[model samples]
Target chain A: MIEFKDVNFSVDNKIILENIDLTITTNEFVAIIGPNGAGKSTLIKILLNLIPNYTGQVFIEGKLNSEWLKTERIGYLPQKEEYDTKFPATVMDIALMGIAANKGVFARFNKQDKLKAMETLDKVGIKQFNNAQIGSLSGGEWQRLMLARALLTGSRYLILDEPEASIDKSGVNSFFDLLSELHKQGKTIITISHDLHMLNKYCTFLVCLNKTLHCHTETEMLTADHIKNTFGEALKLIEKDY
Target chain B: MLSYAFLIHALLGALLSGISLAILSPFVTLKKIAYMGEALSHIAFAGIALALLLSLNLSLVTMLFVLAVAGLIGFVSRFFQTEETNVITIFLSVAMALGIILISAKKDYSFDLASYLFGNVLLINKTDIYSLIVLSVVNISFITLLFKELFYMTYNMTVAEVFGIRVKTVYYLFLFLLAINIVVAVKIAGVILVTAQLVLPASIAFQYVRKLKPAIIISILVALVASLIGFYISWQFNLPTGAVIVLVEFMLYLLSLIINKRSKVRN
Candidate 1:
């Protein structure tokens, strides 16, 4: 559904991302893993068009990168939802923000929209917290709420950055279940996760970056080699502990 | 309550400021830009000081000059967003320093430190009412029209950009709304103490509401209550109206903090 060919980007003449080429197929779950400051997040930002003035060719569904706006085809969930946490809003209210996105300032949401929002929240397992203030939700519940917010767009593609970061071990299992359910619904899931063990279960494709680009399929990608190469000496310490 | 003309003026100004501050407060608190917004008010105070020194319409001059300086601060800070605290500190220092300089230079600058510190509701006049009406209409319409873009930008700016939202335009627009709210509030609450009205309501609203509309609506209601109590307390005690209003807001904030603690213990 998306294509990036030879993307090169520099901030203030310092190379941030370089020579990146990859294609994200429809209904595929791909994770790009890397160490801190490894350009993994940069790739996501570039794809989302957060970082402008980049050198590359990005096409979404055969359209030029510059031509597309944030349509209902894609939904984004950021790493940290610190803003909404401190604010007093209910789960239903945030999910409804996706619907409000399409409406004008004066336009009111219809009954159908509210019902759909509730349904989305239910799917994420936060339906019980539908009326509960989002700040009052636990970490796991909040992540699910974020998913519901994304699903409110009814988008086929979900771009989640560090979706499981906030959740704990028990929460991660539930989050995995949530992802599995979303996957079953024939949605395209492109997530950037640090969890390496998920390559066999959820991730069908993989990309690794450390100020450069590397792409491999599940069959060809080796875990230890790629991690060591991308992370440098840090991976050695991790391997020693493991 | 007795005089028709005076009452109308008071109501218009209060409602206009109440709504404007309601919408602007979330942005200030959520983005952690309260410090910057607070400093801009002080900068606005400096402009008012200068206008009074020249015997000009303090309101008009304050609006134009603060907006200009605020825009400059906005532009400069975008390039230096490595640390939010840095931007906050830089703007706060500049604004505070300039305000002190201007105030100290003029021996008879009659911009009462008390009213500006807390806000003088009793000083509400016809001219202030007219300005509030214009500001309220403008702020409400602007926020309504750009709600989606602003929502996206404030929550996840990168996502907003990817979706082709004019982030720079929206960013500057946010600054403008903030500047206007500061001006609207400065007259009623006074410059230094307006932070109570601007941030406390939203922070309290945020603690209870998970949705934007309810949060905003509740914040306005909260502000209205605080404003009324403030006016009443000052009248009863024969004290500065602004300080009373600020104190009312302080109590609300304290109440919220206690509630937060109780909830955390329960969780």
Candidate 2:
């Protein structure tokens, strides 16, 4: 469990996020949603204890963040993590990063590690592209690859930003399903995104943010007040049938 | 040919610089801040100028002064300034001006500016060798102690910060490591040509591999080979060692490009 109390962050003298309070309970899928430039990304960052210079106190498991060592407990996937895709690396090789987190750098991957990596990739439907150059994959394909990586880590807490942003409808659905399965398995997920439709099924909690934050339960329903407070405009349910 | 002692030292210097920087460059290139090399190189030049103006030993002043200036610039650029390039450019210009002023005021300038501009294996001495060993040790140790921080920062700075990795501390450490490498390299490829060590090896490795470790390994191999062969050619043809090393690096880059193109065609 992680908590941020009265957190504020500024970049280049421009106020990004201010007076923020967030808490992630056990096995909670908190989807932080806000319009573009609404400081959603900064909120996740603060929860992780990344920006200590910012004015606030962050406690991990009720201890000062400085006292807590970051374990392989939190798995992360960035919004646009680029790879040499042209660089000759296999899907298995990428997944091994999870293994590296557990085993020291010098430890060789054994049979079980390889099998787990393969199983994860297969679940994401890119098992056949195991040896394929990451660069050769399409946008949607790469997203799945990243998902497979996060899943393989078996991290208790998964932090993903906009996993469905570039993926096609089918890929988005499958990814959402994967998240659903992961949640059922008791993984805690913290994600930041603006795609309400894709997140509606899996997300149990929501933090509508725009420089400030308002936390609400999913079934509580997003009100007109919540929409204006978060997005400063109407919620556009633009459908891609996605 | 065997009696040429300084030539061996120069070649060894290049080899070490190439190999070490190659291993280190992946982290630098990943963050797209490879310009740390250029920034530190100018700062080294400023050290040389400071030595000249103070009438101190050229090598000692250049080494110590550059290290200080590099640290100063690194500290300022990472903490105070938002745009690194803009800060580096400002420091670089200041260093160039200092170098010019010091050179103009001095009456007896030892050695042609070319050897200092490029590299001169013919001039390497024991002091240079000693400095390279010490500086390389510092660079490698710093990297070893902070490999996790470096990897995390490279992949994602903001996330790394949240994970309790001191992003600013890592930034300063990297800048210092890069600065040390530049200072040690003055005896091999000179200040202006230091960019090749920082950029060339890593970029070439990037062409061949994807993983952070392999790219770094391949880069060191490529750089070491280029440095040794370049020195050999320079010795055999009685040519400038600096230019030869750079030429060899360029050729490797070109060869890698060709190889990549061919592989693309086949795929």
Candidate 3:
């Protein structure tokens, strides 16, 4: 579980997130939605302790986020990075990085670690490409490989930033399906995404943000009004019978 | 040629430098910090200049000076959210200007600054060889043990931090190692020509290899081969060792590019 209490983050005195307060409980799939420059990624960065200058309290599992990070594991997929295509790493090598915390800085990857990486790759449907160069992967395959990396450490919580950016439409369905499975297995998921409809469908809770907390409620409660308030524009929500 | 003790020293120095520089190359190139290497080398010049000015041990004083500057560079770039290349560029200019001013301030400047600028491999002594060997061993071991962390951090620092990698410590350690290697290497390759030693082999290795493990191995091998060939060429033609080695490395990189391109075409 994570909690943000009266968090205010600024850059050059321009407030990024103002008086923000929110809570994410265990096993909850929460999607944070907002327009560009809406502090969505900033919130995640604060939770990860990447931006430590924020003036507020952030707790994970009843302790400060930094303290929690020191003791606990949180699987993370960064926003789509612009990596060198010739970076000289196989898919398996990239996936193995997920378990780096468990292995520590000096310990070599054991046979068990390799087996786990392979298994995780299989879960993401990328086992066959395990030895292939990561740069050679298609965008969809790359996202899946990153997913495998995030899952390799057996983390209890998953934090993904723009998880769907690199994934194709078809792959997005399977990706969400995998996430849904993980949620059913009781892993808390926190993701930042722009696809409101998709997030509403899979995410149990929705947090609309726009330099402030516009709405923090169940997915069903995220009406068009909340979207208008958070994004500064209104759009019709598609009705679907599930 | 091998019978000459000075030539042997040069050879050993080149071999050791090749390995250490090559090993550090991937982290430099992959992190896109080639400019940092350039800046640090220029900063090494200032250290050398100050050492000359104060009549201190060249290697020791330069190592200490570079270590401090490198630490500052890493801290400023990380904590201040500034562009690292820009920080390095500023340091490069300031250090170069300061080095020149320091050198000029001393009226009785007996040291041949050109030797440190363009390298005099034949001047490498027993102590320099020993230092190179020790630094190479320590740096290679450090990188090997922390290879995964370095690779992950190079790819994504935020994700690496979130995974509890102690990125700051690792990052600072890396900068320190880089400083040590640059100081050790400045004797053989000189400040101006050293970045080639830290960049070319790794870039060449990446052109052919698909994994960091093999890439590093191949890079070391490439460096060794280039150093040997360059040393031989310099011996036969009486050329500058640093420039010849860098030229050889550049040729190797170009060759790798062609080879990789041709293979892609064949595929």
The DockQ-derived docking category for candidate 1 is: acceptable
Q: What DockQ values do the models have?
A: 0.30, 0.25, 0.64
For candidate 1, lDDT tens digit of each residue in B1-267?
456665456545655676678767776676666776787788887777677666788778888978877766666777755565566567667766776777778886656666665666656897777777777678777767776666656665654444344555777778877787787678776777777677888888866655676777778788788767766676568766656666787798889888978998999
TM-score result, candidate 3: 0.92
TM-score of candidate 2's A chain against the true A chain: 0.90
- Model 3 Cα lDDT, one tens digit per residue, A25-97: 8999999988888899999888888897899999998999888878787888878666777667789888988
Cα lDDT of all candidates, in order?
A: 0.72, 0.73, 0.86
* Segments of candidate 1 deviating more than 4 angstroms: A9-16, A33-37, A70-73, A104-106, A136-140, A162-186, A194-197, A218-242, B1-27, B79-123, B134-174, B203-218, B252-267
Candidate 3 lDDT for residue B228: 95
Error of 3 at B128 (Å): 1.1
lDDT for model 3 comes to: 0.86
DockQ of 2: 0.25
* lDDT score at residue B67, model 3, on the 0-100 scale: 80
Task: Summarize candidate 3's per-residue lDDT along B114-183 as a digit string, tens digits.
Answer: 7889788977999989988898889888988887778887876766777776666887788778888888
Model 1 chain B weakest lDDT span, ten residues long:
B158-167
For candidate 2, give the lDDT. Answer: 0.73
lDDT leaderboard ranking = 3, 2, 1
Candidate 1 B-chain TM-score:
0.85
Q: What's the CA error at residue A78 for candidate 2, in Å? A: 2.8
